[model samples]
Target: MPEGIEARLQEFDRKLRDGHFELLRQFLAKDYFGYSPGPGEPAASDRITDLVTDLKAALPDLTVAFDNIAVDAEGNATAEVTVQGTHKNELWGVPGSGDAVGWTGPVSIRAIGDRFAVRLDDLATPQRVGLVRQLRLVNPADEMDQPPHFPVVWPEFLLRLVFTGEVGDRPCSHLDQITVSDPPVSVCEQCVESDHIWPALRMCLVCGFVGCCDTSTNRHMAQHYQETGHCIFRSIRDDEGWIWCYEDDAFFDKAMLDRVG
Candidate 1:
């Protein structure tokens, strides 16, 4: 929360607000990566002027709003932003919804000397499946007949680990130590890309079977649950993160409730 960084970010906001995109080049470094969420192609901007005209036309009301900004231990600046605008022109042939839609994703600013040299954006899902999951949380399955923007998998297998002899148990292990795996590649099957590895955390530090993360290409971990009807697996990474119930795409507190409910 240093005043200096905040001021810079605010200035970027104002420029975007006024559609003074031409000025963005001065602030961002060359070779900036800009991901057009949904069906459009991913683009890289070595200079902000690279896409200024196109962006302004597509997002007539385009405004950049900062949801959160963090400076990681690596000194990399990450900006989580929400882009909302009406589809004013032809974008990937979707025929302007003329409708305003919103999406969220992370962008990384690589700093060099006085300015950023590269801006990297790794995620932008126009499918917006997260919004559907939130909706289902409030309504029962029988009540809502609509499907999520993304696919949903119900678990095919069930496994449980307990601690302290209670439905609610004490922490047995941290996130980094947890691991999971099934037959063959196990959790690697569902991933979409090779850049990320599968089975983020193995089901068992004891077994060493690893699964892919949701962020990974195909969502192998979720598929592992659906195909095998398997219920639980230890996460691949360590942290305060919780075990997820694959069937519902939710975090589970008790093993029994972890089933596709």
Candidate 2:
């Protein structure tokens, strides 16, 4: 590591130790993105600042020690940090347990020119989960139950291709490739034939066939799935942006739906 980078890390420690948050912001890149695991987007400066302030209020004696700092030639660095604190107040909607906890976790930082952006890996360990539960960040019942299905999916190969493009193993339906049906086909094509109304509509990724969603009276989408074995469908309504796979029982964000359409 360059002496300058090491010095910067030391300065970061000092600023955090003194609760100099505004001073810390001066060291971060303007477009910083940080990863946080629970319920929010990756952290930017404002988000991290808010979290730090809330944590400080809840744990007045909180302190951290950074170790195993490793910097690459490209100005990216990572470290493991040991954190100790006492739960003393409400945080993230959870009332404090009034207990002291200590843990170690990893942190990563990337430098853009002289400024840096940081990401913290707050994985859900038993201790961390317990702490968050006590803090009310999550419902205790939901935490104790089986976790829901994974919410995000990005296939490893062909990741560079835009999702709306033709890069998936499944061939695009001839109708989809030709032109999307005008007016977005708000009604399910099959439901109209059966003289039934559907609550929602789903479009087949492979064939652009509009079918009623599973909740609809007819469940045309499931029928389509059974008959044609077309695995993926997207909500035709503009309100939702998720694609579902019947075979995998998985959901994909539109950006990762390249394989289907």
Candidate 3:
């Protein structure tokens, strides 16, 4: 933890996850520099933002629990986080069937001066990504289609097949956490919408409520916990989705699971 930077970094993830772009822009520098191979088929800054936006929609209660944050004396910080949420909406282009999916990946951020200047990384699980590539088989966008801009041409079920694995054969219990903007008080969120917002966000074995990816902006997923005092959510949209808990104020990993029980 780096003094105020740790909390600040967490706040940034929340803002991005919450679809608070204005806040993100305010906290980040106008001319920031970032580098990574992510969402954009072409991988550009805007595409990265779009990808983040999409992820938010996919997992309304999406939370990026950070693993480590390193900030130097120069105010430059790089944090590694695992984005957890659900798949409840349209990803790529196909409509998500409110399935339980989760993605496991890392995010890299760069901070400078009084704000972050750049950030990049792929956030979805390799399985979901493969599904997207497979989808390209149908409605292939020219290689010129920028990442975050290209569209997947398969049904949402393919993602489940590639990511969720066989129902009982999951790597971990308390799988994917669904997220929504305005849950029905009963369900944390829904991902049936084109934007990945499931009506009811599922809970994992650890008792956290993560949301779908950026598709539906199921902000209510995190909001539900914040309102009800629950933490720990997984991306229900990625096959390898992980956990994010506010109590620990961090993301879940193998070590966490070891300690949780």
Candidate 4:
């Protein structure tokens, strides 16, 4: 709603369209940092410029259409943008097949006078990465020192254990697979990397992505929730039978979930 905020965003969009990387510097705060979902410091402004440059080089017709711009009382702005371009060169190790690629994602930026501090949406980059994976353009890089897969620790599968019987009408879609697999998969699928320790684990039934518990040092389960938008995760710990919906912020009984399997 602020006129100056809208003007600044439009200016940034123009810079992106024209490949005016130098001009973009003027719009960024001196202490600007861009964030993705990771356990590292947010990337500097230069990094984003570099990414834009690379994308422009690969897709000469690259253009962005911004929509749903919302500016709060604090002059913080969020926008949903759709980027479209024809793939003409390799990106992220994916060879271009001369196809048109378009993806929609969100962006957040803070206005400080004429400059803004951008926090790049955490899901956008991964959505693009996963798109490349889905196209089969490149093989997944080999994982090193892979940890064991799930179900290895349980010697005997317990079929009758139920954590709670009261789900209170919450939509629990995660329990569908429980009828087929007594304990679901064995290890945390995402924590199989080396040197990762987890106090507990849960599995997302919607996608089978395993993330470490909230108490873990990395708290990868929460990260997984943010990245995938999958709302439910079931306890994978020994003899545990509870399921949680991240969106609802409520606990549910495994019995009430839809049996999709």
Q: Which candidate is the best by TM-score?
A: 2
Q: Residues 1-261, candidate 4: write the lDDT tens digits.
A: 478888878877777666565675677664342222122322234444555566677677877656778888778888876667888876544556677878666667677668776643644334534433332332333321122222222111111111111112234444443323233566655566656766567787677677777656577778988988777777776466557777764454454443322
Task: Give per-residue CA lDDT, model 3, range 3-101, as digits (tens).
Answer: 566567767767766657545445654442433322211323333355557656865665655556677765566665455555666665656545454
Q: How close is candidate 1 to the true structure, as a TM-score?
A: 0.39
1 against 3, candidate with superior TM-score: 1
Quantify all predictions' global Cα lDDT against the true fold: 0.43, 0.56, 0.45, 0.56
Please give, for residues 59-137, the per-residue lDDT of candidate 2 as tens digits: 8887766778888776678887666688887654456678886766666777655666665554434534443444444
Q: lDDT by residue for model 1 over 148-175, one digit each (tens)?
A: 2223221111011111111122232233
Q: Residue 142 in model 2: shift from native, Å?
A: 9.9
Q: What TM-score would every model get versus the actual structure?
A: 0.39, 0.49, 0.38, 0.45
lDDT of 3 at 151: 42
Clashing residue pair totals per candidate (backbone < 3 A): 39, 2, 68, 6
Model 1 residue runs over 4 Å out of place are: 1-6, 32-44, 47-52, 72-74, 117-261
Instruction: Point to the candidate with the largest lDDT.
Output: 2
Q: Where does model 4 exceed 4 Å of error? A: 18-22, 30-43, 122-261
> Which residue pairs in candidate 2 collide?
94-135, 94-136
